[model samples]
Target: MARKVYGISGMHCASCAAIIEKRLTAIEGVRHAEVNFATEKATVELDSRAPSLDSINDRLRPLGYLLLDETHDQGAAESETAHQATPKEREEAKELRKNRNTVRLALPSAILMVALMLYGMLFRPLPHTLYNPLAMILATIILFGPGRTFLRGVASFLRYGAATMDTLVGLGTATAYGYSAAITLFPPVRDFLGAGTHTYFDTTIIVIGFVLSGKYLESRSKTRTGETIEKLIGLQTKSALLVRDGKETLVDVSEVRRGSLLRVKPGAVIPVDGIIAAGDGTIDESAVSGEPVPVDKGPGDSVTGGTINRRGSFTFTAMQVGSKTMLSRIIAMVEEAQGSRAPIQNLADRVAAVFVPVVLVLALLDLLLWLTLGTRFMGFTEALPLALNSFIAILVIACPCALGLATPTAIIVGVGRGAENGILIRNAEALEKLAVADTVVFDKTGTVTTGRPAVTDIVALDTGTAASRILQLAASVERLSEHPLAGAIVEAAERDGTELLECSQFRSEEGLGVSALVEGREVRVRKPTAGESARPEAAALLEEGKTVAVLEREGRAIAILALADTIKENARSAVEALKRQGIQTVMITGDRAETAEHIAREAGIDTVISGVLPAGKAERIANLQQEGRTVAMVGDGINDAPALAVADAGIAMATGTDIAIAAAGVTILKGDVGKVPLAIGLSRATLRVVKRNLFWAFFYNILAIPLAGGAFYPIFGLLLHPALAGTAMAGSSLSVVASSLWLKRMKIG
Candidate 1:
C-alpha cells in the first residue's frame, strides 16, 4: 500500500470536510481518510490496486475539491516535477489552512460557551417550564455544532470496525445529550406526591465546550512544534539570474534549466547546481554544509543551488535545476519523514483500534450491574446518572494525548535544536541511536581534515637564495592551475603576503605538479628525486609522511614544500569532547598508512584504519561491531555511503553529496564536528522527556479515572461531578503539552 497526501481545495467549513471524507471513504480499498478543513488536505491510505491515480483524481474533481499533485517518495520522480512548490511550501500552506480552520471551529464554540454560561448564571431558578426548553436548545447546538467532529470520528471508527479517542468522547457526549433530552421532553411521573426534576443539559454543553477548547489548544501547539522544515524552506530565494543569448534575465528558480548558464552576483543565492566557469568568490555554504566559515571557490569549482555567493560574481552552466536540486531533495525527505508514522504511533493506533469497543462493553456491564441490585435504594433514574458518568469519564480520560505528544514533541525539539546547531537528524530513531553510540568512525579527508591540501614546511636542498623565494616563484606559476596542491602552494604564499615574480609559459602535468618559465628560467615543481638523500631533511619530513611538493629550477633542486591535508580547527577539540563522553574516536582513510598515522596522532584519535577502500570501510565497521562496538560512521563523501549504511548509525555532513545524505541516517547541517557530541546529548534529553511525558499521562489517568468513577465514594462519599470531570480531562491534556514545552528550554551539550 502506498500512502498519499494532497491539498484538498474548496473545503469551506468542517461540514464540507466531512462530505469529502465520506466520498473518499466510499471508494473501495481506501483504508483511511483524514480530511482536515484547516490544512485543506486529505491524507488518504489505500491499497494500490483499488483505485488508479486518474480514477481518484476524477472522483475528487466533481466534489469541488481538487486533489493537488501527490508527493512521491523522496528521489522517486525528481525529473518530472520541475515547477512544483518545495516540501517546505506545502507544509506551510497546510499549517496555514489548519490554523485557519481551528480558529473557525474554536471562535464560535467559545462564543456559544460564554452565552451558555451567562444563561446559567443569570437565570438559575427560572420556572421549570422555561428552564427545560431554553437548556434543551443550547445543549442540542453544542452537541451537534462544535461537537460534530467527535460524531464523525465515532462514525468513521464504527465503519472501520475499530475504536479511537473519538469513540469514547462521542459516546459520552451522546449519552449526556440523550439523557438530558429524555428528561426535558418526558417529565417523570411522581411515585408518591412531588415530581423529581433532573436534567443533564448543562453537563452536556460544559463537556463539549471544555473538550473543544482542549482539542483546539492541542492542535495549535503541535502545529507550532513542527515548523522547523517550514523555516528551512524560507531560506531559499524565489528567483535566479539566467543568461540567455547574451542577455541576462531574471527567472523563477523552478524555470531555470540544466545546461543554462547562470550569472551569480556577489551575495546572491546560487539558484541552480552548476560549476564555476569564471571569477573568484567565497560561498557561505552554511545553509547546506553547516560549516561556519565561507569556502573559497574559483573557476572550475562546483557550487550547489541555495548556497549564497559571498564575494564575487561568477557564471556557470547549470547541471541540475528544480526538483533535481539538492535543497529540494532534502525538503522532500523531511516532509515524507514527518508524515511517516513512527513505531510508537503505530502501537498507539493499534491500541486505539480495540479501545472503544472495550470501553462500550464495560459501560454496558456497569448499567446492567446497577439494574440487577433492585429498585429499593435507587431506581433507573438514579442509576442512569452513575452509569453515564462512568461512560463519559472513560471516554474523556482515555484519550492518548500524552501518547500522541510523547515522541513527536521530543523529535520536533531534537531536530529543531540539531538544525540550529548545524545537525540535521532525519528521524527520531536516529537521534535515539546516536545517544548510545560507543564508537565513531570518521572519514579522514573531509570529516576530520579540511580536505584541502596546504604547504606546511619548505626545505631548500641547494641554497642559492632563500627557500621562501623559491616558494614565491613556484606559487606564481601554480596560481594558474586548478590542482589541489597548486592552490595550497599559492595560498601559503598569499597568506605570507610574499611577492610572486611574474611567470610566462605555464604548463600543468595531469598527475604530476606544474612546470613554468618563471623569471625567464625553467622552474619545475614535482615529486622528490629518488637518489638525492636517503636521510635528507625532506626525506625525514616525508617519512613523518607528509605530501612534499618539490621545487626545482634549471635541473637543480631549490626547495621542498611539505604539504598535508590539515585538520579542521574544531576536529581536535571535537575528538577530545567525544573522548570525555566515553566515545572512542577512530579514523578510516584511503591515504597511505604513514600519513593516516600522522593525522590520527595529532587529532588524538584512538584507532587508525588506513589504506581502506570505500567498501573496506564498511567491512571495518562490521568487524568493529563483531568485536562488540556500536559504531557510528561520520563521513561526507560518496565513498562513505556504504560504511555509513552498514554502521549502527550514520552521520553525514550536510555539505556531502546527495548520495551520502540519502544513505546516512543523520546529516550534520553545520560542518562543525562538535555537533556530533551535541546530537548525542539531544537524543538523551529527548528520550528522557518522552519517557516522563508518557509516564505522567499514564499515571494521571490511572489515578483520576477511578476517582471520577466513584471509587472513593465508598470511603469519603465524595464522587467527582461530571462538570469537574470535564475540567480535569482538559487539565490532563494541558499538563502533557506543558511537559513537552519544557523540552524547548532543555540545554544540550
Candidate 2:
C-alpha cells in the first residue's frame, strides 16, 4: 500500500472530511482513506498500479477541492519559502496582486460593454459605411477582448473532444459573428438572393457581454465562500521573540527551530507549538478546539501554535516548529479539503459532458425535418434563420446550473445551519451518510462520562467510623498524590469543602492505592480485603453495581468510598433522541465490565460491549456491519482510532487528539453528542435538496429542448430568436441558483 497525504481546503466541519473520504474511497485501488476536518488533511492508502495523482487531482477540481501536496515534500519546501515571506507581508502582497488583476479586467470590460450598448441603440441607422465599419470594430473587441476567457474555455473543451456550456455560447456567438461578417462583406449577395436585411453582430456582442457579467458575478460569490479561511490564515504572527544566550531576538516562526526557547507576551499569539515551561496565565484555544472557554496553564502544560495568549508573560521551549505546527497543518488541510470532490458532483460532470452533443443532434434533426417538408417558398437562404435559431436555442436551453448547484448549495446551507446548532459539518457527503446512521457505538470513558471518577456510595466493613468520615480520611491521603484517581479523590473532597488532614510521607502504589500517615495514624486505601463482609445495606448497594474504594487504618478495614463514572448531563437525552430516530445505541469500552455497565445504565444505552481493547472494538463494529447495520462510532481517545477507522462512519469529539481526528470521518466541533443527530438530519436534508436540484436541472432540459427546436411553430408560427435563446439560457442557470438558495431557507429537522 502506498500512503499519500493531501492538505485539503474548504473543510469547515467534520462532514467535509467525510465527503473527502467517500470520494477518495470510490477510486479503484484505494485501500483506505482518512480525513480530519480539524487538521484538514487526508491520508490515503492506495494500490499504486490502479490510480495516479493526476487522475485524483482531475477528479477533485470540479468538486472545488484542491490537493496542496501529494506528499510532505512540497509542504516542507513551502515552509522554508514561507519563513522568508513573513506571514503578514505575504498576505498583504497577495491581496494587492489579486485586487490589481481584478481591477484591470473588470474596468475595461465594463467600459467596452457600455460603449457597445450606446453604439447599438444610438448609432444603429447611420450611413451603411459608418454603421458597418464601427459595428465590425466593436464586435471584434467585444468577442475577442472581454469574452476571451469563455472562448478559451470553449476551445479547450473542443480540443479535449468534449463540450461545455461555454462551448455552446462560444459556438452560437461565433456563428452570429460569421453571419454578420457575410452580410457586411457581400451585401450584393443578399440583395440578389432577396434575403431579409438581418445581421446578428449586435446580438452576439450583447449576449456575450451579459454572460460575461454573470460569469464575473459567479466568481465573486465563490470568493465570498472562501473568505473565512483566508481571514484565518491571515491572522498568524510573522515572527516570534526567540531567547538565545540570555538575549531575545525576533525570528520568523518557521525559522524558530525545535528546542529554542520563545517568549510569549500578553495578548500575543503563540508562534510555535510548545509547552508552557514558565507561565501562569490562560490561553484561548478556541481557534483550534472550537471551545469558548480559555484554559489556565502552568508549567508542563502543552500549548498549541496559533492560539492567542490573553494575559501573562511566559517563556517556553518550542516542541513543534515550522510546518509541523498545528496551525500550518490546519491551513494545509483546509486547502486540500476545498479541492476535494463530492460524489454527486460527478453526476453533474457526466451530464455536462454529454449535453453539447445531444443539443447538436436535436438541432440537426429540427433542420432536417424542416427541409424534408419541401417548403420551397422559403429557399435554403430564407430557411437559414430558422436553422440558426434552432441551433442557438438548443445550446441556450440546456443549462446545467441546477446540476452544478445540487450538492454544493445544499451543503453550504447544511453546514451553516449545523454551525448555528453547535454542530460543524466538515463536508457535504458526510452529511449525507450521517442522516441514515442505524447504529451509534460510543466509547464509554471520555465519550459518555465526563471521563472522571466520582464518589457514588460508601460502605463500612468492620470499623465504627461513618462512611463519610472514611471518605474524608481517604481523600486526605489521596490529596498528597498526583495520579488521575488521586486527583479525582482530592477534587471530590474540595468540592464538598471537607477539611483534609495533612498526610506525611504518602506512598502511592501503581495500579493499587495510596498509603500515608495521617493525624499520627497509618491510613491505607486498597481493594476490598478477602472475607470482609459489608453490612446488609452496604452489601446490597455493592450488588446494585458501584466501584468501592476501600479504606483501612492499622491493617483493619474502616469504610469503603464507592466510586462510579457519572454520565454527562446531556448523555441521557442524546441517547433518547437517537432511539427516537430508530438508531440502536451501544457502548464499547476498555473499562471493566461493572464500570461499563454502570455508565451504560445511567446513559440509557441499549447495549454494552465492555472490556474491549481498540482492536476488539473494531471487531465489534465489523460484526455489526456483518449483521447489516450501518454503524457510526463516536470516540475521543487515541485508542479509539482503529475502531473509528473500521466503522461505517466515525465521529471524533472536538476534545479528541489529532490522531483520533485524523482517523475518524467526522469531528464534532462542540463535543456535543446531540450534534450527531443534528448531523444526520442535515445529511438527509442535503441529499433531498440534491435530488430536487438534479431533477429540475434534468427535467427542464427534457421539456425545453423540443419546444426550442420549434415543435410548436407549425400551429403558432412562433420561433425563438437567438437573443431569446440566450435569455432563456440565462434564466435556466438563474433558476437553478434560485432553487438552491431556497434550500438555504429550508427548516432542517
Q: Give each model a TM-score.
A: 0.80, 0.77
User: Which stretch of 10 consecutive residues in model 2 shows the poorest summed lDDT?
Assistant: 80-89
State residue 475's C-alpha deviation in candidate 2, in Å: 2.0
How many pairs of residues collide in each model?
9, 27
Query: Worst 10-residue stretch by lDDT in candidate 1?
Result: 188-197
For model 2, give the RMSD to the true fold. 7.0
Residue 691 in model 1: lDDT = 73
Writing each residue's lDDT as its tens digit, candidate 2 over 40-140 gives: 45778878564666688676655445555534344344342243333323433454454455445544544564575577578865455666667677778
TM-score of 1: 0.80
Residue-wise lDDT of candidate 1 within 1-749, one digit each (tens)? Answer: 86778766544323445556667888887888865443345778888556875687677664445666566444334332334464534654674566456446544554665575577678865566776688788778767876676676567556653344555677777887776676667655333212245566766677777766666676566566556666656656667788889899997665666888889998888877789887878998776655678999998998877788899888998898667776666666555444434344444334333444665676666555544552345676576566567656666665555555555565665566566556667765676677778999999998898888888788877767786787798898888888877888999998889988888888888777788888789998887756644547777888767877778898887777888888888888889878887899999999999999999988999999999987798999999999999989999999999999998889998767878988888887645677777777777777677677677766776776676665676578666656666667667666766776676678766
**Which candidate tops TM-score?**
1
